[model samples]
Target chain A: MSQKAHDIFFRSNAPVTVDEDKCIAHKGCTVCVEVCPMDLLAINPLTQKAYMQFDECWYCMPCETDCPTGAVKVEIPYLLR
Target chain B: MSLDNFLNLEQEYDIVVIGGGTAGPMAAIKAKERNPNLRILLLDKANVKRSGAISMGMDGLNNAVIPGHATPEQYTREITIANDGIVNQATVYAYAKHSFTTIEQLDRWGVKFEKDGTGDYAVKKVHHMGSYVLPMPEGHDIKKVLYRQLKRAKIAITNRIVSTRLLTDASGAVCGVLGFDCRSADFHIIKAKAVILCCGAAGRLGLPASGYLMGTYENPTNAGDGYAMAYHAGAELANLECFQINPLIKDYNGPACAYVTGPLGGYTANNKGNRFIECDYWSGQMMWEFYQELQGGNGPVFLKLDHLAEETIQTIEHILHSNERPSRGQFHANRNTDYRHKMVEMHISEIGFCSGHSASGVWVNERAETSVPGLYSAGDMAAVPHNYMLGAFTYGWFAGHSAADYVAGKEFSALDKEQIAREKQRVYAPLLREHGLPPAQVEYKLRRFVNDYLQPPKVTRKMELALERFDQIEEDIAQLKAANPHELMRAMEVAVIRDCAEMAARASLFRQESRWGLYHHRVDFPERDDANWFYHCHLKKDQSGRMVSHKREVEPYLIPLDDHERNAYDKLRLKAANG
Candidate 1:
């Protein structure tokens, strides 16, 4: 009766990262989040800064190119790298 | 978190273009040019600034059909032969005849093509029998050019909306589109007199061999949305059995791009650095040779650029790394494999349905009209053989003009309330579930099953098992839970992927022949059967809403090939010197 099936978390690095100091997310700019093809980047409510919320990075770098403040950097995922 | 559904939001457009990629933008622009008074809506799941197959931009046009380099007749003959005689020649001819016009249009629009000293289109010979590859050394700005045109035309743009299904009327013609925003989960209902679906290939149908889910040749956002949407709207899909399997850079899972580097002195080589095939143009027959070499004693295949001169290698690197998939350079650098010292490892990509590289997509006539009324298609999702990016633009032009004419005196068909409600429930079920399977897990499993079974050298039993497994996965689809709208978008994509998987299997089963080389190599029927199976295999949703497969006869050729030209692709394998 006590047998439980629960979820566990695995750690991996996010391929797309945003520099908080330059993000301008709190100042109301969402260009990096808006231009991402995969919709993987979002602004964290607590931090008021953009960040990658999913591991599904295609490494097709619109977030880096389209960013207004040059805040986003895309690295090839470890597996592919 | 409770779902923030945008139920009350509705829209109406005179003509709606469902993807803002290579084709959809052109469709909207040309439709406006046809009638500037018509209200057109250009929509996408991502920002139009960065979307579709050419999101990062294309390196070159795979099929250019320029004036002095190749005529429409020659290009048509080449495509007809490459596809093994199962082509809608009228459609290919239409694309061929107008190919130069489309190139001119792009050229005038500030998009550039490679030019000779005399200002002629510098078309290179990459195909087995024709010169079609037109390099775009500065082609990375294609999306920017399209975006400029879209804005100058004053077209309305909506981003982040994933269009899921088509809304049909009482007579079963597409009248509206139903979808949700991936970021906000807001519902969209767009009413129109005509609709065009340019939503690229079903690229995410099979799992890449690397076990990394996101690494696919086509952008992962494609995910078969247009193919599934067309089928549900009663549009016929042609040659789904002839799958798209490219020879990609091994673990990176992107194109090695022989089209660009082949003319520059690079070629596909085996482990011993010997050119096994005479031509590097991507064809099912060529892929078949590639698979043979990979399975042969030269087990690992590679892109051989090590012998190229230093200047040519630098030029190749600049073009390859800057356009299409820019991260390719990073991947090569991470592995520390320089093209000067070593060959780049290559492998066959997982299969999908793409009419751009191979002929498998929603059936569209020469006018770009689908079987269903008021519906049109172009791009990788539309069946026009090796249409590539230029074909997307050309067919997009056709769909736009055709839809503009079709909707001139047309009236909007009434939307069905019941259909909307049913789709709303289906779309939001995963978001409402308390706790269950995750969309990513389900998608990973489904695609892995696709790789295990439906990937070529087709075994009859394995495909049947794939259908059964796909049916089981539908149960898992129902149980899928999403914590947020972003996840919900992926959840809906999983549903579309499942539909495409089922279609791929059923269509492969109906073909019953080993044609297109490694693409549809049915083990039981191991040879090309022209007598019984020369027709194109089409799949669609029958009147009863059941999946059905039937053979559609290939249209009579507008340009017939000579005996020697017909078998050019078949003799691609280079014979040994002694033999």
Candidate 2:
């Protein structure tokens, strides 16, 4: 399969983004990945950060606020806001 | 197919409430009643009938009042004692004083109650409110009431929705919320002066059983969308720690104490059927005070429930049988899917299930402000305010009022685009990756570990191992990828599981002693540990993104019930009877 040009829109299956410096890697991101239920999460080896595979992602966070580390963050679509 | 039109829709309202539970409708209706012609909209992921975990027209009631029988003071003490007094005094009163009114309002709206021919409503015995305990309404019943009210009051009801982001203008205040109607899969731009998140908790995310619905009453629609949405909106949260536990069931299998409480009727047993609670765990006081015989000891200890009095057996049988209701498990859209249905059937169906699942959630003040601005939390979603399980009615009202109050303000500002962009990246980065195990794997491993190590009570060095297990599970979860909505939701359950772990760990570490109901085991701390542990565990969402756990002193109050509040209430009770 070819790599899809990751379009990280809120409504899309894409998970949010990550700023390396800002992430505490507090285990919260893991929750967001699992909460989505669908295999929406794809961890990047190079960045050690989370990114959404839009096509695969379902937009709920099960590992939601459970993480003590608070690494995972949610981004609502700008339009809805 | 185009969500743009919906996304660009700018809507203004006198009040914008997030949840449609018992309290949300009340707040919206009351606000409108407080002022007619107020444009108010109640946004919920599902129908208003099933907004919260618990609804009206059921046996559960906050008003535990019995005429010429029970008193609120005793009720207060029993509850406070069960919660170890971590409950908010004002909050306790808020529920205690207004319970009658809550039921009355529901009744006025056509909520049915199982009452006696004498025109008196019955009580759950355990859930007695002040002077009158209201009847439990079915989730469906509540939806009907809200549907009628919303239509009549001209309140807009948005359904099949999930709020994804909290929109703040240039200033730090809330502008509105970004959400989507899952049924249409169309994103919506909910621009409002303020946003209130009444979506319930991650309890739906915990193990096979979630919250009140654990025993076949699970609400899959209660996906942690609200908590996640609120966290991203920049509102701080508290006590993301402290999930209610009693995820315990009467299933006849497992290893060690963590697996099963063994037998019922005060008997304790292990795998070999030898008496455990009676032989080992039972205290001297228990042996002397209680008169149950502990014959035939091995590993599993079981109180001989057979040949017991019919009435006594019937009571226990009723509780066990009541677990048959399929309302909770069948309600959530996610549970119907193959992956999740297997889970619900496997664990929840195993004979013994406890209503004691969990009662902890986000921490909030009387005003319902979380750690962040332009946001609030409520319901079972709210953290450990008092050690008691606050139902949908209380938190629903609190969050609704708090958020509505916050939004009514005129001050407005815009958010810095740079920070917003950064937040945007944080929110969806995980969805774009290709590598790692699926979120479902992480969810499974989490359930497996927490069930083994951190279930409750016996706090020990074992927690470190559990935490380590969590670490591995975390890595595994980070790898999960979704195939569709079904798979995605199962994965989401993992997120809730992780939160429960964190909350449990937070309380476990801080509370070096055992206390409270259902979960607080004596071997864990051996004492209430009130002096150091009476405070509430406050959790919040930091920019890095999970729970930021902390502690706050539970406000101590006298109410000065002083014989007078008691006398006054007693007289009122009499007057109510006569009238």
Q: Model 1: per-residue lDDT, tens digit, B1-579?
A: 433545547999999999999999999999999999999999999889999888888889889888878899988888999999998899999999999999999999999888999988888988887888899988999999999999999999999998999999999888999999887788898999999999999999999888888889899999999999999999999999999999999989988879989999999998888888999988999999999999878759999999999999999999999899988888899899898998999999999999998999999999999999999999999999989999999999999999999999889999999999888888889888878788889999999999999998999999999999999999999999888888899999999999999999999999888999898999978989999998988899987889999887877778878987788898888897113
Compare the candidates by DockQ and give the number of the best one.
1
Instruction: Provide the lDDT at B559 for model 1.
Output: 86
Q: Between which residue pairs do clashes occur in model 1?
A: none
Q: Provide the TM-score of chain A alone for each candidate, in the order shown.
A: 0.93, 0.47
Q: How well is candidate 2 docked (DockQ)?
A: 0.02
Error of 1 at B417 (Å): 0.7
Model 2 Cα shift for residue B14 (angstroms): 5.2
Q: Write the per-residue lDDT of candidate 2 for residues B418-528, one digit (tens) a residue.
A: 644443333233344454456544654565566566654345776767767776766666666544333444454455456546545544565565544324453556765
Please provide, for model 2 over A1-81, each residue's C-alpha lDDT reduced to its tens digit, 9 standing for 90 to 100. Answer: 976444233344333554445554443344344333223455565666565654331122222333345655544322211
Clash totals for all candidate models: 0, 123
